[model samples]
Target chain A: MKLTKFAMAAALLTSIAFTSCKPKDSEIKANVEAALKADMKMANTVVDVNDGKVTLSGECTDAECKAKCESTAAGVKGVKTPVINNLTVAAPVITTPPPASTATVLDAATQQKVKDGLKDINGVTVDFTADKAVIKGTVTPANRMKIMQILASAKVQSDVSGLMDKK
Target chain B: MALQDKYAQLLSAAQTHGVENLSVAEQNGVLHVSGTAKSTADYDALWALYGQIDPNMASGDLMMNIDVKAAAGAQLKVTTDSTNLNIRSTPSTEGEVVGKAAHDEVVTLVEKTDDSWWKVRTAQGEEGYAYAQYLSPM
Candidate 1:
């Protein structure tokens, strides 16, 4: 009888250890997110885990990013399936940027300001370094002038030209 | 209020911003919104509104399917001066770099996600956004 009891206790302990090895949903989610963030391509992806199933939602630049995210999630401990849903791929558009114009160099401060100002501008992109600000995308002539003036005030070189297809 | 009702303002904003084929459905306290946003700003505004209502998206009650479209198949030249272009997961530089395109390498443009980023798929099928400045139409 003692031997049988010992055997039963051992079986119970084994089951408990097996169950304990499984991670909780939240833990799995964190693990997946951490793994993804470590990857530059999956950095922006959001991970959601429920009952061992993982769902990745966010803007993925292309199919490759989405696939990698899914694979990463699936490889996580306790993840049953990795689903890629609501991840949109922003395709490229053929745009007729306005004729090339002079490239102006702007200071870092002015470059930052230009980027901030154009944040809400539709289809507008601002890129600048310590010495130059390059604004692309379609913008109104008035808005273009306003941007240039901002750069001018900061004594930074500005290139308010190129990719200036009138919006 | 129902989850969908809670997000009424966000729905209205999405509508006002011209999200195409907009649809809203709620189940078990989760609100789902599916539509096509006209631009990145339009899509962002919806999320911003959600943030105003639910900070850090704590509730996780909303599922957004808003999508943006761009040219299906276009080729762009990488003109990142001389440095290899980083292919990001999102249109923003803050996005994760999933792949890379060598300078001057011709990448198939997937979409102009916004002014700053062009979604491109490389010849090997690796896809991501290259800085718009570094890319020119072929």
Candidate 2:
């Protein structure tokens, strides 16, 4: 009976030691989730922990975010090898930039400012025909918005309309 | 209030402790700092890095523009220009004179004390301290 009691006590002690050494599974999950959302700005990732192993999944807005989430999750303690499955990386949004050509009533100086502004971005092909600037180019969403915002800042007298979308 | 207060407290602690080795973290707006510092000035430099702060004071927009050395153990070049150049153990002239450098021998800056003396290393990996005035870029 003493031997059985001793064995039971040892088992209990071993379980306690294991529990203390390993952080709570919920804490690990919360940590992984918070780290990704805070650092990577990923709203789609899901975190799960089982016996100290963490698995993260879901689509991220971009490739940089996906990589950041993986690295950050690995850095947090209590995560033994995170299994990040085939995470879908959505292509960044590409906003169409308005062309600089169409000014209804603008002076030479104003036109020059608009033209100079359009020239700042590389890979942007600007074609002017009939006082209408045909701004054609493919740019990342952020850059596209920045270009449009610059044009708006020019305060041109001309009307900028019908920025084409070719593919 | 808590974040701003925390940053102020940490900044004060850093100044009180030292500034030479300042390591801090600015998350959300609360700046969490640890490690050794060189002086009060170094502590101010660390706070200055927080060019902008978040509304809640939990997020910090740190703009770091430090011109760090290109390589580890990189040789910083220093040239002695003054006619009477003095190599002092500390940044001040009153500091104990440990060694002397030539008129144009460039040395690498290994460490910087709060005072004027800079610990510099040469191309030959020789390390020593010199007055800031007599030293110029190679």
Candidate 3:
């Protein structure tokens, strides 16, 4: 009886160790799959997080989506500079308006005000479509003025997006 | 009386346009202007408003109290070309050289003088005069 009890305790300890030793690869793979499944918009993508280093793989719709994925990874706790590969860019196609959770609309006068406000800053592109407002452009370190001018006056309903999209 | 009347008018106009707590008073023909602005660039417009009020403010009896105390509306980034750009006592080199600044640093262009020297901010938030030549809308 004593030998059986000792054997049972040893087996229980071994089982706990085995459970704790799940492969890091599987954990990262599960996380990536979960993210992709949760959001169908993220296609052709793979995410790898190991010891705080993130490697985002796969081609995305545009530079904005690629950047968005990288930023999302960076926001994760302990995440370092994401090694973003397998990403390419194409002209942005507006299939349907970004989800109500992802988009916001400004009234006529306020939208005009934002447009006029953006003109004062250089190296920024602001396009106002009927269904949505898209702001995407590149700002060199030398021309960061454009960043402030855009963010300063940019007022969306909420986190719909700041004034400037670092495209 | 013309300047006073117009200053009052401009102050009222600023309040109407969402510029709050703005006060304008002229003493002995010198315009003592005081208010908060949204950004450093926004104040360039205040001077324009002042110009419409009295164009003679150029090289004339007009003093402005434009304290660049943390603009509330907008965040402006001011950069300097030369590293450790010397901040002197006066606009001239002969004046006492006070401190230094770094490159790509953002600050506020709080004031402008007749000599075209713009009083900008430092990374440490110290207000210093920078030559207008090395500076522009940023």
TM-scores for all predictions = 0.30, 0.29, 0.28
> Which parts of model 2 have CA positions greater than 4 angstroms off?
A91-167, B1-138
- The number of clashing residue pairs in each candidate reads 18, 23, 2
The CA lDDT at A83 in model 2 is 58
Query: How do the residues A5-53 of candidate 3 rate in per-residue lDDT, one tens digit apiece?
Result: 9999999999889757654545655655555555455655777766546
Backbone clashes counted, model 1: 18
- Please give, for residues B1-138, the per-residue lDDT of candidate 1 as tens digits: 478678889988988998998877664455656676776557556766865876434344665645443365867777543667788887665679899888789888787664445688999899887655455564
Candidate 3 local lDDT, B6-119, one digit each (tens)? 577666655655544565555444444455554445645655665565542322333443323342222334344345455556654444656665555555556664223456
Candidate 1's displacement at residue B69, Å, is: 2.3
Chain B of model 3: TM-score?
A: 0.48
When 1 and 2 are scored with TM-score, the better candidate is: 1
Q: Where is the poorest 10-residue window by lDDT in model 2 chain B?
A: B56-65
lDDT of 2 by residue, B12-123 (tens): 6455655434545444432334443343244334443332232111122221211222233444443322333445555444457566555666566667542234576655
The 10-residue segment with the lowest total lDDT in model 3 chain B? B67-76
iRMS of every model, one decimal? 17.7, 20.7, 19.0
Compute the lDDT of residue A152 as modeled in candidate 2.
34
**Model 3 Cα shift for residue B69 (angstroms):** 3.7
